[model samples]
Target chain A: MSIDAIHPDWVAVDWGTTHVRVWLMSHDGRVLDHRRSDQGMGRLDQDQFEPVLTDLLAGVPPSQSLPVLICGMAGSRQGWTEAPYVATPCSPPGIGQATRARCKTWDVRILPGVKQASPADVMRGEETQIAGVLLEEPTFSGVLCLPGTHNKWVRIVKGRIVSFQTFMTGELFALLEGQSVLRHSVATRGWDADAFDIGVSQGLDQPHALAGALFSLRAESLLNDLSGTAARARLSGLLIGAELAATRPLWRDHKVAVLGGNDVAQSYEAALAAQGAVLHALDIDTPTLSGLRAAYAHLKETT
Target chain B: MSIDAIHPDWVAVDWGTTHVRVWLMSHDGRVLDHRRSDQGMGRLDQDQFEPVLTDLLAGVPPSQSLPVLICGMAGSRQGWTEAPYVATPCSPPGIGQATRARCKTWDVRILPGVKQASPADVMRGEETQIAGVLLEEPTFSGVLCLPGTHNKWVRIVKGRIVSFQTFMTGELFALLEGQSVLRHSVATRGWDADAFDIGVSQGLDQPHALAGALFSLRAESLLNDLSGTAARARLSGLLIGAELAATRPLWRDHKVAVLGGNDVAQSYEAALAAQGAVLHALDIDTPTLSGLRAAYAHLKETT
Candidate 1:
């Protein structure tokens, strides 16, 4: 198919702290082209974003002024352009609340992050993912678990985010495994299911002793000759277990839809299953694309 | 007094992971001279320890084979010489269990660390301090809390270390303050008492929710405009409170003696007081020197 014959309907972008991903969608709801780069908001200055983004969209036809919808950290004050946060107890912000970038070639709009004032929580990209979920299953109302560097647990009632909480699980794990004394005991790569389960149980049962438990991993290596693989698994389990213990109220009664990458989502699934909670895993990419699609449709109708 | 006229009786050293501290003691039990350097075990190889020690002791009179008693990481498996650990449920290892260093000029003995087989815990330098605690009060029986990078909570009964637990409170605090995203919301040098107390109460009340609570600090900074100083104080309080919550069984009914640096010990004292526990703070330097003195006495008698 010639580029001139088949014009892209719109473009979707997920700009995070450390990465940038872009997808071109056909009018018939088909993925035409996809590209990714390390040129994320975290690595770009205000003036640098335009050039980097322009380079990413170089493959697009010169005449095609397709509407590009952006989400995640790109909307933060420090990103491409500030897209003010949309308060919760509301549906995800669409094109109506999006901020426009000063670009001539592309009609670009950046999605706003979601903020909860009372508990003081804010999310940029996950809110769009939730919107994607609501688009696919408009009646889907329950808890949404999005695991990443900073994992988010969201409650949805009648297709709107009610309240949410975030955990420093992923960041804490990275710090412990990479920088803490536990680094000496755990391997950078490996896992042990038994040790993981044991650590999870301990974390759930007695979270106040987390600091002590973390130290024991190192002590066990020196004393009982514990393996690096087992140590890694246990460290992950301990962190995830503590997160689960804290979010019990969110998952105890409601069925959860986990939106994350494969490994992290599986970990959460295993943990939630142990808690006897029903959960379905969903790949983060699909919903993010769907969310961008939904926002594009909204833009078409509103404009 | 001239260095030639007043010869030192023995040298006491506390060589930890990050720093080397040494003190010269007289025959009359008076401190002759004291010196410190950044030549900790963590920064050097096995071969470098002797040279560092010799340089630190260059001021001493020549031809004097001064007896040197050392404790801490300098005796770890990877240290200057492997000082075999003394299995716990016993008194701190004295000269009998001390390992001799292959030194030509100085008669050096490295103190052995204490290890617990079950539950897998170990302590190197703190055990010496614990022995020092016993030298002054032979019948003191209670909990001794040592706060540092790895905080040790020791159980003492009739001048012997019965059991103990290690918490990574200080290490965790340092990591969060220096590396984590929470670093942006915490001042490097400032504190808020109210925020600290509030964090302590919350951490003690719901330690399982610590990960969530930590995130809230960042959120509060963005949403509710929480101060960096307050956030820093609160972060410290939460970690300490969680540790206190875990060690409640050890300190609830018994009087606690906190042996640590001034600031850290004071923090623990405040946390313990809030828990309605009888607590006293002791400077770590005194007990460390005393322990080395006691070890030197044992060395003199055994020889």
Candidate 2:
């Protein structure tokens, strides 16, 4: 169908563990409106998804019903429905589809997340964002890093997400400082950038010993009486160092682009800068919208 | 106090969380008797420590009363009393002492653990084990790896601990496979050494990318349908590989010795072998005893 042939509205949903966001767009694919709910897929059981989705879409006109494309953790085994995984080095063009969930007047389809070999990692909604990046910058190439709770490093070639990797740096940091024994020894303030830099240098210099370095944070507190912030920075360096060791090979020769929340992205930028790599930072939210829009566009073209 | 003049019967206590081990040693530190109780320091309130110790030693003859040396988590802040940390590059002669605990005729002293700067990590009981190694093989010098929940990579010169580092490799592996999102994507058994080697190589080659590589385990499983054991092996490789990258620098010119539980020690051996490092595996239990004995001997001679 041609773009002008249908009066359908386009709805894009990025449903994750803690938040649900829906974007409304016109037939021409321009965003007409947007709404977000705190009822993230992470907090709800499988059965409650449809009702929550319906409630979120309550005020829309029936005739303006659009094909909704959903992504993120909402399509995992524990999600509303399990979306099949798309193999690595593959792009949104090859992303599998969720069996469409039929609302009374609209057809709703969730976008499948991408998976890859090589380093071996998975992504849910981020793949869509990558797809959007590809759509917006068709000729862009090399490594795209999406940093967050589970940071991802995607390799794109000629607009395809040929391969990617993920790191649990954010999660590990949270657990160690907030949940582990080191919590007692650490303070809430006083982050040392120099200490962080030291960690980065050590991490890049000696990735295998990164775990051992973590214990040093506690030791510094007990032995040298380092401030809590320095300990926190040390912890960040340890994580970043391990990350650098793991990802250095993948992006060795490639130009890098970091995509994610601001603080995380900045940290990644700093890490890349330390290695003397060329890098670019893109807004996570914008790329996500563009990715969702691209998915809708692809679906429209295919059907 | 000469060994010949000391009384014949005394207590050797390995007090830790979850379990208490008591060895009734002869004046010369021979195990004349041994017993264990579940009343570990971890389960008791701080004020209850003395009473527990007293209750456990209730029936021992007073004439055989000897000095008691305690080790492990019992000396942590949450345990009987906080044993202070000793700074790194510490020799047998430089070991710190815990504030003494006295009961009637029995004298108690907790062994202090070792600490290091740079990465800022610490360890308590392991240094004693290093001391034990020094006692058993006084001429040996190189890297000693004590692997456990928190693995220590220690440097020894002559008979002193010059430096050390700790890794939470075991803990991370357990958390990822048992508690994280990747848990369901991996298998419970069937280890693949080759896959692990691949992970190690990747980590070494791209030390900076370690974090991004971790996410690949789930992605590989989702896209390629990797066997659970293979997935698990990949996970191990990623972690071990990262560890190798971090630690390799320290052991570049040094001989390597591993002290740990058999299986874990074996893994460390395999990783080090893959890196073409000379390695020695030491029994963790025996070394700990040797370390305790060494400490006791040192104390006896000095006092």
Candidate 3:
């Protein structure tokens, strides 16, 4: 089909704190077009979301009122609209339970975030991705290690989320590398496996010594001329090792399904493999697109 | 004596990364005048150190070629003149081995920082404080916990520093509470002991679970309406608890003497006490001043 020949049946969005991603879908579930923008929840006020969405879709030829299914921080209380969370021990909410945002020319549905009451936790866009995972494999049961800025180690029993924990590992790494004194020692690129292994081992062996271990990076840089590549890898390894140490209960005896971006997922895979665990890597796009499709399907049938 | 009646016999300086503290002393060891400046090592170039010191002392009446004993980052590689490290398992460097900076009117000696070759660690100002502590007690031996921006837990055997480790706990706490996502959940002031104890206990128990525990602060804030005071205390307890978990070998069996500003030192004392560790709280100024005195005495006898 030519660029302007076909019209999108629906739009799937993954809006987060820093970026917004959109996939234009045909009625038959094919991706017609994809778009991205930096106008995320962190940058927009409540009333500005619809206008941004309109602008993003301006290039697409006019069609009948398009169905827009959005997931992620856009559903947060501080985002476009408050799509109150669905408590855990339950299935991920779909179009039937999603909150609706008023728009002049479109029917917009935002998937609700997930919440855990006891320990107090929440997940926005990951829940949709989880739904996508579930759609891909209905019988899969194990721990899902979703690596990202706020990494989520989710425990899935059958299909429902039993429990999950979030780690500030990725965020912490960025802050330390970009702002802390360790920035001088850790390089922005080129990783060393041996250094990473050393860091992981140290972190796992003396998890409590993390604060001390961090300072060693700076000292080593000053005294021993530790390269940035080595420091970067080691820093990653240390944090992931500490995370794995704390999360041993989730993936120790059971097989784990690693999900998320390739680089971060590989890092987790390596760390998990070091512990002698069975693992499988799943492409992140599969679940996210699949979850969005599932949500669209639900919206079609329900309303 | 009136404020301007007595002239300083010598000057003692404790220059750190963020602040410079000067003590003008009489011949009888009395503090004749005291001044502080924001012109710390981090702020000044190597040449600026001499000029800055001269400006800070311009107001005080001068004596002929007064002796200036300097410690802290002023002795670091990037500070004034690099006072090379004295390796561990040795007494803190004395005036006999101090580095003389090129100053026109003052006899300035910068105390060397301490380094541990094996673990790759170093301390600039704390070593001087350790010396002061030893001078006061004369026969004391154990671990000295020095809390500050970068906290140090030093293991002392007899009069020498056997080994020491540094923790970025204070720095981590500041970053998390001031810059990270947890900032919104943690209060700038006020504290809850129960929350702190809970965080500390959880940190010690899981040691590896720290990264996850941090995220819970934000989660609880959203889901449970957790108070900011509670989150603040909990965050502190978690970091300190993790430190304690790592340093159990150093302080579990041996008594610890804590030296730092009032608030931070108290936090460590509480955390340590909860672990059944005996601790003595020493005023921070006590050891810093005493250490400078001991170094001055060393200079008097030698030079």
Best by DockQ: 1
lDDT of 2 by residue, B3-44 (tens): 222233446677766788777666576876566889987589
DockQ of each: 0.81, 0.44, 0.75
Model 2 lDDT per residue over A1-303, tens place: 222232337778889877999887786768766779999876788878877887777666554246777888888877888787777666564224655654555566777877655555677888888888887688777899887888777788888888766788887787777756578666655667788888788777766666666666766777778788888887888788778766776657898898866776777788788888887655445788888777776676877
Docking class of 2: acceptable
Ranking by lDDT: 1, 3, 2
TM-score of each: 0.94, 0.81, 0.94
Question: Could you give candidate 3's per-residue lDDT for residues B1-303 as a string of tens digits?
Answer: 334444688999999999999998976789988899999998888889988998778756554378899999998877999999888888877887789988876888899999898789988999889988888776678999999888999988887899999998998999999989898789999989999999889888877889999999999999988999999999999999999898998889787988875888888888898889988655446687788899888777876
Please report, as a residue range, the 10-residue window in candidate 1 chain B with the lowest summed lDDT.
Answer: B1-10
What digit string (tens of lDDT, one per residue) describes model 1 on residues B45-149? 988998899878766764436888899999998788989998879998887899998876788889999999878999999998988888888788899998899
Clashes of each: 0, 45, 0
- Residue B93 of model 3 has an lDDT of 78
Task: Compute the DockQ of candidate 2.
Answer: 0.44
Query: How close to the true structure is residue A260 of candidate 1, measured as C-alpha lDDT?
Result: 68
**lDDT, candidate 1, A185-212, per-residue tens:** 9999977888988888888887889999
Model 1, residue pairs in steric clash = none
